[model samples]
Target: MVINLAMKILIGIPFVFGLLVYKLRTRHLSTFNAIENFLRSQNNLMPISYSYSDIKKMTKGFREKLGEGGYGSVYKGKLRSGRDVAVKILGKNKSNGQDFINEVTTTGRIHHVNIVRLVGYCADMSHCALVYDFMPNGSLEKYLCCKKSGIHSLTWEKKQAITLGVAQGIEYLHRGCDMRILHFDIKPHNILLDDNFTPKISDFGLAKSYSNETSIVTITAARGTIGYVAPELINRGIGAVSYKADVYSFGMLLMEMLSLKKNLIQNTELSSQYFPDWIYDHFNKSKDLEIGDAEELGCEERKITRKMTIVALWCIQMNPVDRPSMSKVMEEKFREKFNLVRGGFYTDEVQGS
Candidate 1:
């Protein structure tokens, strides 16, 4: 009798656990279905929905992979109208579809020359994807950091143009939009370029929105690339969370463009690490910047480099309050007045202006 009772108890335990698992799975599916339905209802203005089969057809069975990142893999595809597009396939193992939802909702409403346009999306069960205009030049990281292999031939003027365009896009997100959007990730990898070398801000998975009534938004934790993350986000002692975090990232990006080196260095001599500090020291002492092959640079190129360096230095100030706003950074008056002197100093007239 005792042996029979013990066997029955074990059987009942498995049965109860199975029932609980089934109920949890059903709840999850119900919630997902509701969110998917809501997204589909709002598809007219934003991105149109595509079935999983349609995504497969567009990507040609994932034949041509453009790249892969922390989120998922991107493939190069062609639309029915023969237009080129890049399709991003989100990984299925994600904890939830929050990243997918965040990207779709945030990028759908934004329309700007410097911001990448979301053509469409796919939210089929277990398969999520986003479609965007094909950027021929890919990301800005290749142009700045990969120039050693002679792949990128961008001149200083073009680099400056890209910087200005990206700044304008960020300014629009911060001030022009109905709600202030904070781009948690603002690195070179997120900046896509078109055939004409025009820079467009891409990747909104980590983006967050706040209303004008709130100046400081609370974040559960730090959300950005390590090298580019603002000191404030990493350590609350630095300052409160604000749009200035994006400014700091942009400053780091600008410095990378000027120096043509990756900010994070590993397996290198101790003295060579922390390139930004070295750059600041050089600038303070009126020393020549260590850009590769200085003799090959023209006078105009030198001037542009100097202007960008000074602006980047100001943008990367330790205190968020000391950093200039994106609007001020985009001011034509400031650019027009900037005149770099031979001694790595600017004219007093420009400063006063």
Candidate 2:
């Protein structure tokens, strides 16, 4: 009996030691894998891999200015293949390295027809820039708000198509990826228009990704442009943050598209009383609104456009839950048309689709 008991103890000790060794090895492998993924993600984040010198040669010392935004100045360039590109140079010694990393990490991996493509990047000290496929038409904001271009390039059908494309791009960002990507910024300016007039969603620097269980990401300070920011985000200091903030911004963008007006009216009775708050309140009081530049649209087109305005209002509802999902937005745009009309005019300003 004593010999058998001693044998059992010796075998059990070896078994326990072996289990510990296996566990340690597994953990070490996991850590190594994470490190590997981070490095690999960084290495391949930007699609274009040109050396800084090659980029300078293409831009000709940043000769042709394309545009400027909150990030930096953009210059036009043509690659060896004769493909035009937009080169965005970040400010020298800029403090927003994290934003740069986010742009590279997220935008680099995303490839879709409606989303802007990141052709390359330059991350050397004293200089940081991102290269993207040059969008010839500039942004939707320019056509809608800027008057410099005397003629109206965007027709009624074009507006509908642009709206559809933008929605599709946002839907792709939210649900098309392996992870859920929240575009913390979704204003008109972030939406670029291609030569073909397709709306391509751009600027991933302010975006955030979350897992299924994460309801919110901790933010040290408020992010996103004002007027376009969601109410919850504006009030983020008082409560936790969530992805729904994005939905709210989308709502604002929708309203902007509907009205063809910037939502930044300050100290006006209209903004405090009617702009956002009135959208839903007016909807409740009356199911739709007749909005848009009436001078540009025909009576029949104006009626159809009103239906779209109603849909936009639906998207911009104060409650995130009230806003439809991106999939639903697509369905609303394509699946059906509203017949709510008065004498060949849809009671609403535009059709939802």
Candidate 3:
């Protein structure tokens, strides 16, 4: 029996290794051809293709690094047309090319003023990269966590406008697109600001899309940053994950816009009250707000600020059912109840698809 077991183990080892090698080889080949496959297929819009060598030339040998993520690093690059672009070069991961495929296909189909523009992509052999219009102001995160004296604090007007753009962008994903998309990851770091301080949603690596047939989806695993993940994603008992999950994440992001920068549960001495509860209580009672720099805002600006604050608190409600959907911004009930700005907070708005 021991001899038979040893013989079986030896045979199974080769079989397992061969199977892994086959899968890897298949993935490697598919990744090498993903761009071509995407090009031949039908899409709402067709972003051009770029060669790997072209990426190197544009990125100047990856000299100016802008940011890094679990999958890869982003570099500052300039296109031949003299346009500045941010290039994302995918890194090694066992997901093979699944993430690169998702990022390319997802961003390629959608276009909204608040959504980042996908200019082109590179998928030469195992090397893959995505090119996007460069955001001059970088991410909303730097401002949220900034302590540098040189970093000019964003005015109340700018803060509200930026968050409003982000909200609209997320709403577009949920309702405006041909396919309903849930941005499983929505955090300050994923929100980019252009020269005008208009926020554009970025980082589609974790995006999940559903057909117009259904708003609810059952993902195999929870997806989002630690602080921004909805309670439903973490505990099934809370609710089924759906578009509301994205709403919950946006709530967390908006809550931080009020200057609750750190996770209060982990960082604050106000153990008696949940952070959102504190904001809710203060805003309702008209108590003096210690939020960021709100005390200095003028009366009109403060009214707008407090109104948005209420919306933010409403977003972070513990139950997914209680939270408002992103598209609810369109409804009169949402408009009157949340008092979300009459028009968008920004002026001279232009949308590019």
Candidate 4:
């Protein structure tokens, strides 16, 4: 009888522990869900929350994929209102949820022509996604870098307009906002164009925000694409970290637009060669900016190209302090004065000596 009692107790002990474990797990999950709900409700201007089911319905079962990146895949979807939207379904493998939060918070309050509009987002457990206004013309890279057939179709005027639009957008982020927002990733791929070719800045996954009083922000890790990342970001010893990093990125992008070539060609023997050096040399030698179909370019086109080139050079200065503030770059007087045709001595104006 004692032996039988011992066997029964052993079986009961295993069952009891299993029951406790299951209950504990259930309670923890409930607490987690409650906290998440509270946080979601706290965002005053938060974007509309969509459920996982809603995302699936809106996306029509991921029917059309727009593109894919390190973040995740983007699919073309339609809202119930019959409006089109681009749904970015974040990858499940992302270790941290910071990028998802960053994009939503950074873009939610911003309302500008040059900035991409964040329609809404989904944070249903492990399934996360972001919805944006569908860009009809797609990314600027498709026009400038790829689709060689359409390169010439983007006239110098359109290119200049796109560059100006991007600058204005960055300027808004830097000064127009309640806090300064630094776009760590600024490249051709991030600039989207509408049906009318209006450029809007997108992809704020790597962006950072700081108060006006803050001069230098501590960077935990290097941010931005390789070719476009500022020298200061790669090596803090080079210069202080500030909005100037974005300026460097914009400069690299501007150079790419002018040169009509990829800034960094991978796995090539000439990878060591930097294109900015060629830009300076070309300027000094009075060589034509190797804009494709240069013979077809009119006088105004040349003027715009020269002005953009000069501004780009100033932005990419080795020292962060040397770069002009975005506000200064957008000033009317500065724009008018710099637009004048100088005899291949545009550097003098850029140097401001």
Candidate 3, 195-307: lDDT as tens digits = 99999999888888889789679798888898789888988998878888888788888778776535334455765665555555545665544555555668977776666
TM-score of each candidate structure, all chains considered together: 0.83, 0.76, 0.81, 0.81
Cα lDDT for residue 106, candidate 2: 77
What lDDT, from 0 to 1, does candidate 3 have?
0.77
Clashes of each: 0, 14, 0, 0
lDDT per residue (tens digit) for residues 176-293 in model 2: 8877788888888999988889889888878888674665677766788887776666665444566666766776776776663343334445666635665544445554454546
Cα deviation at 128, candidate 2, in Å, is: 1.0
Q: How does model 2 fare in lDDT?
A: 0.70
Instruction: Report the C-alpha displacement of residue 28, candidate 3, in angstroms.
Output: 3.2
Q: Which residues of candidate 2, in runs, are more than 4 Å off?
A: 1-46, 147-149, 212-215, 237-240, 260-268, 281-288, 334-353
Work out candidate 1's RMSD over C-alphas.
Answer: 4.5
**Deviation from native of the Cα of residue 264 in model 2, angstroms:** 12
Model 3 alpha-carbon miss at residue 301, Å: 2.9
| Pairs of residues clashing in candidate 4 | none
Misplaced by over 4 Å in model 3 are: 1-27, 30-45, 261-289, 330-353
Q: Candidate 3 has which clashing residue pairs, if any?
A: none
What C-alpha lDDT, on a 0 to 100 scale, does residue 157 get in candidate 1? 80
Estimate the TM-score for candidate 1: 0.83
Per residue, candidate 1 scores C-alpha lDDT tens digits across 157-247 of 8988999999999989889888899898998899999999899999998899999677787998999997788878878887888988898
Residue 295 error for model 1, in Å? 2.9
